[model samples]
Target: MAMAITCMLRHAVTTSCYENPANGSTSYFKTLTPVYYPPNGDCSDFYVPISIDYEQPEFNPKFKWTDSFGLQSFMAALTARASAPVPEQAPFVNAKQFKGDYEIAASFCTPRKPNGNEKKVIVATHGIGPGRTHWNSPFKPEEFNFVQYALSKGYSVFFYDRLGCGASSKADGFELSLETAKAVLKTLVKSVKEGKYTGKIKAEKVALLSFSFGSFTTHKAISEEPDLADAIILTGFSNNITGINGNGLLRSFVPRIANIENSARFGDRDDGYLAWPSVFDLIMNYFKAPAFAPSTALFTQSAIETFTLSELLTFAAPANISAEKWDKPALHLTGELDYIVCDGQCKGIIETPAKEMYPNAKPLQVSIQPAASHHLNFATNATGAYGVITDFLDAN
Candidate 1:
């Protein structure tokens, strides 16, 4: 019966965004700002001072898949050599609470013309190996940028780099635990709600849009503070690990320092990061072809970001959270071919698990994008995923 219900939802609204284009009335500027916040409140009391880089844009950058023959060649050579055996990761080290000041990078986009009403803002958090760019593709923006699409629908979007990723403050790999992440997100939400961050546009309510590991952080945040967001969208996620193709996923990552000389794109990044040596491994484990352009794969490899050891250990830590306290609307969407989260098939099996996880959510919807993998936004059918998200937000 559960499988039957999931199948029905899958078939009812599986159209790609390309087939059904989005329409909107406003255009706005993409402005960058720095937001500084002090540690306070229960969630933030553990915080150090932090500066966040923010972006406000009316549209995404024009899509362009510029060739990087040299980078491509280097990647090919790295992939050819056998991957080194992954070393036993160091044990988790919890950062002392209230460790002074740090900085984070973030971006925001709003419609050009205000609708004369309280606006709804979506705060997005990216997964490991990608920062804000994960939400808005640098290459092929039109085809893969969810941020621009949300803007087209008159929705404001906020994206940020986690403490140890992208333009944010760098920390020892073990310093970025789940508890630290929850505090960071909680503080950001509070600042945004108070109009301290994006002052020009005060948000009536906020929604959370998270991908992969970001989804994990979101889960921890919302579980602790049930009213954190009016609505929540979880993508590239699942609570079940029994189905994951772990072996294939594990082999895809090489230590950042393992091939530091070849990774010119990362410059002098430290051991806290990991890199994907094989585009083939990425496609097989994270993306599905035909649904994702070849260039998307290459660009993903070239622009890969760091994934902290603290995050990995935190992810592996046991959790016994209950969603009975959550009462907001929630949605869980994943690619049908998500090898890591869903073992290449998310439909028919995700609904039950999601229900168990978000039991008290008013309307918890779970759907799978056909022909996509874990990285749905980069897939050819990304517009479909985007449409599903905006539609849910509109309905709620």
Candidate 2:
């Protein structure tokens, strides 16, 4: 019965132009390729290509006003006030008050051999996917890796799973919202500040590097708690700004009144990136229905099915705010051909604001990786180190 239902559903739906082009309309569809996440876990975290080789000391230029290549990595990009890595790192508390079995991890890296007194800290937060282990190859421990790259430079590195994603326990999907994500990260930072589990940290002086969904949570933290990080680096992400009414996917199925009521909690509207493509068809199939008709979970059965690229436009522009509200140094990195966060969107959300915020700050230095997709920007022909990321961080 389930197979019959599934086949019937598949037949009823027609793939967009990419899948099945119309008689005269040009097809804009691209192949949907699955990304391979290495089982040894070396390909998960946002990483850089290792092909470009440069000595460590030579890479960290000593002079302030020297002409240098654009951002090497998000960390090395900063030249603000001699931001060095923290002295040491000890195991801190996990994100919750659980009483069961859990794994705890920690490590230290020095950008330059510490001068014994100068202390700096850089903490990396993972996206809404696998954990640290999956990012670094267990077999080739010393090969090109993000953790190893940072640790070699002296930045105290810390990363862990977010609840059920990795070795951690699992739970409902909606619990993975921006709020819950922020709370978990805040808890980790708090543990470091208080020296609760393993001592050794300068809580006041902290930096943040987050990618994808992690970027949203980090931005919310900075917006809510000004003291969390001295500076923030947001790569491959943009704010989810939605203000339009009654035009999202959910309206096609559920009553507009019902959707309006649920809008406050379930994001701006239904038919987000999750419900896209499928939900788009739903809206077109039942375009003439009264405003009160319920939608078919038809194609967008899961929350993941609620989103489409079209909806992203509604949230690309920055929200209005005073200059004083954002005083800290921020670095925004994006590839020119990013299929997910379109270059245009990045310009509107980050590039333009960065120019206004830090006028003297170099032109929103962008790394235009030709023919690169969203994920490939961070994880590409490089190994061990995130050259682009570290370069962006060094650009201050």
Which structure among the candidates has the greatest lDDT? 1
Global lDDT of each candidate: 0.62, 0.37
lDDT of 2 by residue, 334-368 (tens): 43344345532233444554455434423334343
Once superposed on the true structure, which residue ranges of model 1 sit more than 4 Å away at CA?
1-90, 93-100, 116-118, 245-248, 258-268, 316-320
Cα error, residue 164 of model 1, in Å, equals 1.5
Please write out the lDDT profile of model 1 over residues 179-213, one tens digit for every residue. 56666788788878877556477898899999888
Looking at model 1, residue 84 earns an lDDT score of: 47
Candidate 1 lDDT: 0.62
Candidate 2: minimum summed lDDT over ten consecutive residues — where?
27-36
